[model samples]
Target: MTPLDKIRNFSIIAHIDHGKSTLADRLIQRTGGLSEREMSAQVLDNMDIEKERGITIKAQTVRLEWKGHVLNLMDTPGHVDFAYEVSRSLAACEGALLVVDAAQGVEAQTLANVYQSIEHDHEIIPVINKIDLPSAEPEKVKTEIEEIIGLDASNAVLSSAKSGIGIDEVLDAIVERIPAPKGDPDAPLKAMLVDSWYDPYLGVVILVRVIDGTIRKGQQVKFMATGTTHLIDRVGAFTPKLENLPDLGPGEIGFITAQIKEVAQARVGDTLTDAKKPAAEPLPGFKEVQPVVFCGLFPVDAADFEKLRESISKLRLNDASFSFEMETSAALGFGFRCGFLGLLHLEIIQERLMREYDLDLITTAPSVVYQIELTHGGGHIDLHNPADMPEPNKIETISEPWIQAVIYVPDEYLGSILKLCQDRRGIQQNLTYVGGRAQATYELPLNEVVFDFYDRLKSLSKGYASFDYEQIGYREGDLVKMGILVNEEPVDALSMIVHRSTAETRGRGMVERLKELIPRHMFKIPIQAAIGGKVIARETISALRKDVTAKCYGGDATRKRKLLDKQKKGKAKMREYGSVSIPQEAFIAALRMGDDA
Candidate 1:
């Protein structure tokens, strides 16, 4: 068994593109975990999407030996959408390496992660990365970290992962500064499943951090959250690759495959203890994730419905944060309503479904849950889909979700950033200056920022600003459900809930966009946007009529007039009997009209 005092468990947290993976690669190389020939960029980032996008999606754990000490390091995703993943990773570690880009200083996401690590009560070792860049400002960034995060920067390590500079200092700091995992080895087995994924050959493979006692292969284990028990078939450690370990003791991080069939049975943050000698209470800080943004995902072809379901099942095995249920739409046919942590989470899931499963999908406009109070009785319901909203006459009041957004930007762009926030209906709560940069906080509607707020903020700040947000519960708002009609028929997929003041303007924009996207039919197609029974905006696509006169050029005037009259009658009858066929692209365009200027 590995001595508990010799094991140091830690995670690397940072903003996107701050070189967490690169630092991890260097650490592994320095420890002889992998040979120089086997080393590659982002060795821990095994996913192709992660490598291509230069971001970590899932947290990866690797074990390294340095100076006779076992260091287990977890590399976490940097995006706000994957913050929950980072939180889970932190729960498994006793310490954290808060890596910040030297030139960029501290970003919005960096502050968010630093607070999370502090909440976990982990020992935080600050590190300034990318010192090789010509724009690198390690001293400035060190001051920023101290001024912004309230952490002492005197001992913060400065390193460039790309140049192999100060890498030895980082490794030495891990061994000397970070505390070794503390737990009683003789106590009942207690382990936290920080991450889990489904393997076709192994079923559900779980990565767990042993908090106390010991766990071994062939031992019966019970999940404290679900009270489900299964016998472990195999136990191993990640030497960057899965290397079989006879048993995992306290302070060790390893994988366990119990031959479980259901993905839901093995949940992240769930505690695993000996079934025969179960702990009296589960570990603290365990909570199920709640999805914030939701949208309908429909296969473009109905025949791919089963395939979509299977693909989602596989994806769910890896991403437990996302949830879905079978849902059907009148206009878009059968689909699943999937819930995501944020917009990026939604996009990543959709991209994975297409790239991994090769399924064509049509995603409806995303929406947030709204609490509607009944006018007749004081009864209320949470409305997720705008199409499912009750009639306006039956609703007395509506409350939409709100969030507390924290933005970090340079002082020069503060005005533009504030203006963008004000336009999104944000109410400024606090503003402060940190190391020549402005850190602003605002309370805004979650729906307002979930769609296009980040993109707009980046544009206004010239990509110098970083933003993060947390839900602040629902607040009463004047919200109205806006609907779009094609050929005067309501399209369920094109419905959305908007603030009352912007309802008319948003409706007008929707119809105007639809007019441009919808192909002209043989008959005139009328596109309209309505709130309840009141039409706020309208647009028309004139019919694509063929000239009957072109074929009758040689005919007399009387004959031409008679032919034209007959043609007009025929066109009128066609308009009455025909229905417009709206293409898939038109629906996509209409749903995303909110992003248009």
Candidate 2:
């Protein structure tokens, strides 16, 4: 098998909105992946939220041609939440296009991704994008990159993906900076499954990079998992254009359509090869991703519980990022508590679960790992799901997870930002001025930032600040229990833990907000607060049955359940004992109250 003489493997990696997708649009247009008449910005990011949020969530690959060589170009999710997917994208490539914003310099995520690329030994080519903006300062950013990353940023090419200025240099830089895939074409099969897509009509479409050997149509190949064998239904490559080929040799990526009975057989890191000739041992150094954010996913209708479980299983087959287990809820009926990487990851998984699989889901508030003690043992441990939490007085110390956050803002807003972060229990680490902008780094609990932190920061900064962080180790901090009561009785469902310093102010505001979000009930809904089993404050939720029993329509007298559900949406029910029914929305309001308080 001759080397295709025409193929380069590289991917663009960057922080969100650092112009990776915009640069990809420009690169594809100039390199013949798409023509000017066919161009649209952020084409690789086709998801609705990706378009709305202006960030890439899934890794997308496209074919591009330049200087007589075909470049298998890839654009990957840049946010910290999807870092595992980013890692897989990097492992499949030989080089990376590290894009940085001209005005913002190197962000926290930029460094994290750059390190992920380096771990895979990717040849990194730095590109400064957004040079077209009025505040663009490529020179200052170049120095920041050099000092922070120790990269030769002085030689970094400045380009405006929007204006198409100096775009050619970036392409030339990739060819010169990135290495070509090399291997013995005549060797036995060993291809890396880099990416995958599903077509409801076509089953699963597999994307593979031929590290070595060849795969041909009608040949028997065994998927690493399931040991299931299938005929290579078809073989094809893209010269920025789909071209049918009998077979693909070393250094090329092509699509394969196999009779994949299940997605379990077509995982991203799985290897594909001739049945008799397997790789030395599925390429080393790949790890399964673990979820960091946990939440309960209940169906609005209890009858949909099994259907929700089935949908989650089907979704997990296609998405290696999401994880779940069948669970039962006294209030939520039968449901599943799912875990994700973070807020963005949770949003994508939830949206895709509903939109793609078509399930009506009611999600509980997202939470981080909570250290709990077992009543039976002297040992302490970590709990990612609330369902796993032990009964209230299991003997010992408990701590919530924490993170180290770095926020960047303009110099003028430094004072206000500092005050705001401090109110959230952030321990200021350092403050610095980079390229004339102020950056404040702090160590804060992951729980503190889980709700409305982004919204609060934007409101304070007039929408000019950006922040990112990773889970730092946790330490036992001053803790307090926040109890939300209905009719002056504490409801276990609405109880939450908080920093002790914030109990009175933050806790009161939280329970009060719950009073508003929880629906009016058959009886009056009173949202109250308690500390150590003693009620401290109270707020009332109006009673339901708005028009009373006299206003029922002629045929609608039997629709009591429908009316109850709708009415309960705004209220809580106080029971005869110390029990209360806290509506689902109240569960969410308790978390968000900290933002304003």
Candidate 3:
């Protein structure tokens, strides 16, 4: 049995693009976890989307041997959307390697993740990475870390992950500084399943951190949360690749493949214990994740409904955060209303469906849940879709979800950032400065930032700012549902709920954007944005006119005038009887309006 003192289970935590994956690659190379010929950039990032985007979407674990110590390294996603996954990764580790880019210093996500690690009570080893870059400012970043995060930076390791500089020191720090795992191997089996995925042949494969006792092949294990039992078909460790192991003892990170068919059966945070002699109680701190943002996902083709459903089930095997239910839109047809952790999470899932499943999807604008109290009665209902909202007269009060957003930016752009936040009706919570950089906190409506706030903030700050947010419950706001009409017919897919103050501006923008997107048809089309029954803004697309004068060759001026009059009358008749077909591109344009600018 591997001695508990020789085991060090830890994760690398950092903001996105701060060299977490690169440093993980260096560590894997240094420890001979993967041979020199087999090493590649972002070795821990397994998905094609992850590699292309240069970000980790899912947390991955690997076992390494360094100086007789069994070091299990977990690489976690850095984006705010996957913060919950990062938290789960931190729970399995005894320590964390906090990586910061020397050039970028500290950002919003870095601070958020640092606080998460601290909450987990994990020993943190600060590392200043990318020292080889000409813009590297290790000393400056170290000072920032010390001043902002309140961690000692004098001993922080300085390294260039790309150049393999100071990697030895990082490995040494893990061996000497991080505490080893401690648990009783002789006790009843207890393991926390940190991650899980479905396999075609082996069925559900669960990645677990064995907290107590032992888990072995052929033993029956019970999932405490689901109360399901299955005989373990195989037990293995990821030495960069899955290799069979006879048993996994306490403090070891490995995988257990049973005949469990459904991925939900082996949920993350669920406890796995020996069925014959289960632990007296399950592990502590198991909380199910709830999705915050929701949108409708429908296939462009009606026949692809089954295909979309099957694809969703397959994707659900890998991602457990997203939830979906059958929803039908009058315009969009049959689809599912899917919920996500955040916008980025929603985008990733959509991209996966398109790339992996070869699906063409039309996704509605994302929305947050609102609580609406009935004036007629005293009861309230949660409204996720604007189409499902009760009549305005029936609502006593409507409360929209709000979030506490923290932004880190240069002091110079403070005014612009604050203005942008105020435009979104954000309330200033506090503001402070750290090392010439400003940290601004605001309580903003979640709907405001859910769509294009991040893109706008980055553009305003010239990409020098970073932001993170957490839901702060709901608050009463003067909100109204804005509807879009094409040729005086309301388009249900283009309806959105917005604040009263900016309703006109938003509506005007949508109408103008739609005018540019919709192609000129045989009949004039009027694109109008209306709140309730009143039109707030309108734009018109002129009809495509065919020159009747062109056919009057060698004719008199009177003949040409008569032909023009005849054409005008025909166009008027066609305009009254013909219906304009709005193209799919127009809908897409409306969905992405204000996002580009």
Top lDDT model: 3
lDDT of 1 at 99: 93
Which lDDT tens digits does candidate 1 get at residues 374-451? 997968998888899988889999999999999989999999889888878899999999877899999999988877
**How many pairs of residues collide in each model?**
0, 6, 0
C-alpha-based local distance difference test score of model 1:
0.89
For candidate 3, list the clashing residue pairs, or say none: none
Candidate 2 residue spans exceeding 4 A from truth: 1-6, 35-38, 218-231, 238-244, 261-265, 271-274, 299-314, 326-335, 352-361, 378-384, 419-430, 472-483, 488-492, 499-505, 517-526, 530-591
lDDT of each: 0.89, 0.75, 0.89
Off-target runs (Cα >4 Å) in candidate 1 are 375-379, 546-572
Error of 2 at 75 (Å): 0.7
- Off-target runs (Cα >4 Å) in candidate 3 are 301-303, 544-576, 595-597
> What TM-score goes with each of the models?
0.94, 0.82, 0.94
Candidate 2 residue pairs that clash: 518-570, 518-571, 519-570, 519-571, 520-570, 520-571
lDDT at 162 for candidate 1? 92
Error of 1 at 177 (Å): 1.1
